[model samples]
Target: MQLEIISRLPSTKSTKPPILCIHGAYNRAWCWDKYFLPYFAQAGYPAYALSLRGHGNSAGANRLYWASLADYVHDVAQVSQNLAQPPILIGHSMGGMIVQKYWEAHHSHPAAILMASVPPCGLWSPSIYLACQDPELLWQLNLIQFFGLRFVTPSLLKKALFSEPTTAEIIQNYLAQLQPESQRVILDMLWLDLPTLHSQPTSPLLVLGAANDKVFPQFLVNWTAKIYDTQAHIFPNMAHTMMLEPAWQKVADYILSWLQERKL
Candidate 1:
């Protein structure tokens, strides 16, 4: 597991606790580096992004196709344990699911944030909803899930993750860095890897969603928040990749405000 540390000063001198950002499927720590890592670091919080095994420059890239969700959780757990103090875990999409699993296994973080997270019930609800709402889009995602990178099309990618305000250059850069995710992990999301919700999480949790997110839309995000007894905030005019979306700073500001409100 490779931890991409974004620190301006020594951790001991920071006013806020470190933040550990976990990227979603087909993404790595590099995605966080683009906006989140720097934003949080500049906000006076030390930040670190973890490249789960087989993703980004992390070890085992060659065997990623066969890796499971549990394996990804292990990567997160390792990074969490190595941190100087429990970090505020922030995860998006599949990474959010991974954070849920980590919290279930070890409730060490002071707080957690789920951005366009996979629902606690698992991928079935979102999958079924997308299938019903947009069969054509679902079909394209299915193609990518099973067949990998070649199945992806620029138009589909843009519609799936971005909105009208996002420029072509940003979308192109994101696509160029996007890689094929593990089929095994996708399968786990669909079936084998549902997060346990029986035990209420001890840490304060913030659940966020984008109004235009194709994958985990508002309905699913709200459902996720309901299970945790928290509110799901839906940002208008944004899509799945909120961190990289044109209005990314808005999301960052909200998170910072939330942290301050909670006194974390």
Candidate 2:
């Protein structure tokens, strides 16, 4: 149960609620450390990102295949509970669904941000969409679940994650860090662990998506927002991994502005 939580604190203390970022499938907490943690910390919010039990430097990699969505939710609950104050939860992709599950279970966070998150209905729609729209990419992604990084290539990675062509170094670096996601968690997200609308929280919510995200298309993002009675802001020319994109600052700035508007 020793999850890895990476944190960055601002030089000047502020009253803003700490921000906790959750990464998507095939990703770890380090995904946030490169840009988000520092950006938010510099903005005076204590930013933290935690690797789920089997990801990053966290323990339980040996048991990754059996890790369930509930287990991932437990990890998030543990970290957020240990924070000084209730955190503003920001989750991307699968992590976003995790945030939804967390809120449905605890309903204690100050606010929640869902970026390129899966819709409450589940990943079935996207799976179908990808199956038709880009079968190779979908096939590669499935192969990755069992084969890990060996099945990934710069071209496929770019197609799956980025709208614009990324540098070779960046692609290699990400490839090196990418890990196989849990099949059990994937199955849960595909259907088993969907959030309950009846238990939805009343706290503020923000839904964001990339205009060019192939994984969770803009329509799904809109659907996710609509389900929560909110609107989604889709960034043009961005892909699934918005935080690591070239214009990542735009996404960061947008989130910062939203947080400021709420006076969080």
Candidate 3:
């Protein structure tokens, strides 16, 4: 699978791997930073954003049928494996799942960052369970979805995706980047035990969460960090899209500090 990679480099290259960002499912690479690319580049680290197989700037139109959870691992693999030093591998939502799965199966460790990620094996989620109780209801649900696409939720639900930067413009911008698919196969992809994955990490891992995000929620984020025996922090006035929020610089600063403290 071809990855669509865009780079914004710092004025100089050092012997370290630049920060590499991975966007969540149904989103393109540019979803990373309205301010992130230039800010990090200016801060002296080469910055990169990847469009996994069918999303964003990458080439498949199967936006409906052509990608998998592992395909995203391949995307991250391509970008981070070649770093001068291991690049800080950051992922959001489904992208977070990808990073976790990759680390579980491979030797790459670029100090992962996961944001608003879904719990693996949530195909049995209560919401999914309830939706499947009635045969006719299930059929209705399937129609609204493409591959695995869910029906658009109300704004109240959207509010949960972010706490800060809830402006109409920001919402519209994200909506424009949304991709839909009826591909449920990816949802069944089993992830390794989080505790086990965390145990094997060779570098410091940061689990950044939005104080107000409900999609992945604070408790889950904290749980993920705690299991890893590392650190977790909340972004004040931030959302699931921490990398794009008004206080994105604050998140980046945290990332820099985490790396500095651990020397990753």
Best by TM-score: 2
Tens-place lDDT per residue, model 1, 147-196, is 77897777888989998899898888888888888988888888888786
Off by over 4 Å in 1: 1-12
Q: Give residue 138's lDDT in candidate 1 (0 to 100).
A: 92
Query: Where does candidate 2 stray beyond 4 Å?
Result: none
Error of 2 at 211 (Å): 0.7
RMSD of each: 1.7, 1.0, 4.4
Clashes of each: 0, 0, 7
Quick one: best lDDT, which candidate? 2
Ranking by lDDT: 2, 1, 3
Rank by TM-score, highest first. Answer: 2, 1, 3
Number of the candidate with higher lDDT, 2 or 3: 2
**Which 10 consecutive positions of candidate 1 have the poorest summed lDDT?**
3-12
Error of 1 at 168 (Å): 0.7
Q: TM-score of model 2 relative to the true fold?
A: 0.97
Reference-based TM-score of each model: 0.95, 0.97, 0.81
> How many angstroms is residue 182 displaced in model 1 relative to the true structure, after the best TM-score fit?
1.1
